[model samples]
Target: MGAVESRLAELGIQIPEVVPPVAAYVPAVIDGDHVYTAGQLPMVSGALPATGKVGDGHGLVPPADAKEYARISALNALAAAKSVLGSLDRVTRIVKVVGFVASDPSFTGQPGVINGASEVLGEIFGDAGVHARSAVGVSVLPLDAPVEVELILAFV
Candidate 1:
């Protein structure tokens, strides 16, 4: 197994297969020594694990389900990054993570919501997981997923 795969096994994570793009853009792109991943929604087996905005009146269950879905989205983003680098160990730095939180107008916990993704990165990559990040509340997301996350990676 590759570094990412090995680490995931140790950490009990599985880098899911690349989720097919919803539109014209590719799942990821490489520039020089960097890899940029498109926004990844919460997909399991090519289907959304959860869909809906966060905050009041969202989802038949509590919003926690959707929050977990957001975290899952980040895991998928890492999977895409590793696919490009061949090994997560090749990642020298996590440049930035931009997390978009689909939310009700009254919702304001984007940072906490995105923490679901950030925390996973920290656990899987340890110190290398640390990176600049932005969590923004948006009116909606692609396919109305509760959240979407994309990553930028600089490899050694």
Candidate 2:
């Protein structure tokens, strides 16, 4: 297996098949040495795991659950990015990761939740996985998935 896939396997993480485009945009775009991914929802197999908003009017899932979902979303983002870039070794660095969590006002640990993705990348890529990131709380996401993530990668 490839380094990227192997590493993920060692971590008990499997990169799922690339999710088809939800709309007009491609899953990822590789330009020069950088690759950017479209928003990735917390999809398992084919469907979203959860949905709703932060604060009021969306409380099907708790904030704590939302945080966990955010991490899952980030992993899926990496999967999407790898599908386009081919190999994580070719990844010079993870430039940035923007994670959006569908959360409740009482839930403010979005950054901590998205750490699931960050930790996975770090485990697989070491320093190369070190990245700039933003974790945000949003009202809702497409499919109402609890989380979504997009990645920016610099390739070798």
Candidate 3:
């Protein structure tokens, strides 16, 4: 296995299959030395684990749960990147991450939720995972998924 794949195995993570796009765009595209992934929802075996606005209230997805979803979304993004690059080992750096949280009006913990993605990337890639990021709160996401994530990677 490549270094990146070994790291994932150490973390007990198996990179999943690239998620099929919900619309017209491809899951990822390569331009020059960078790979840009489409927004990835927290899908497991082609289904969302949870769906709702994130907050502390009845019928809403909890922030903690949303955090987990963000992690899943990041993994999906990685899968997308891998599909295009043929391997994660070529990745030299995680250039950027953009995460979106379907949130309640009173919820303002978007950054904490996105930390799920950030932390996992750090664990998998060490210093190479450190990167610029944006955490945004939105009224809703495609399929009402609690969180979505996209990635930009610089590679050989």
- Stronger candidate by TM-score (2 vs 3): 3
lDDT for each of the candidates? 0.82, 0.77, 0.95
Candidate 1 local lDDT, 1-156, one digit each (tens): 666568789988877888888899888888999999999999988887666778866343245666687679888987888777777778877788899988888788888878888888888777888999999988878887888999998888
Q: Can you tell me which runs of candidate 2 are displaced by over 4 Å?
A: 54-59
**Which rank order by lDDT, best down to worst?**
3, 1, 2
lDDT of 1 at 38: 98
Lowest summed lDDT over 10 consecutive residues: which window, candidate 3? 6-15
Candidate 2 lDDT over residue span 1-156, tens digit each? 767667878888776778888888888888888999888887778887666764434446766566666666767777777888776657778899888887776777788767867876788778889999999888777877777888898987
- Candidate 3 ranges with C-alpha deviation above 4 Å: none
RMSD of each: 1.8, 2.4, 0.5
- TM-score for each prediction? 0.91, 0.86, 0.99
C-alpha lDDT of candidate 2 relative to the true structure: 0.77
Best by lDDT: 3
- For model 1, what is the C-alpha lDDT against the true structure? 0.82
After the best TM-score superposition of candidate 3, give how far the Cα of residue 151 lies from its true spot, in angstroms.
0.4
- Please state the error at residue 51 of candidate 1 in Å: 1.7
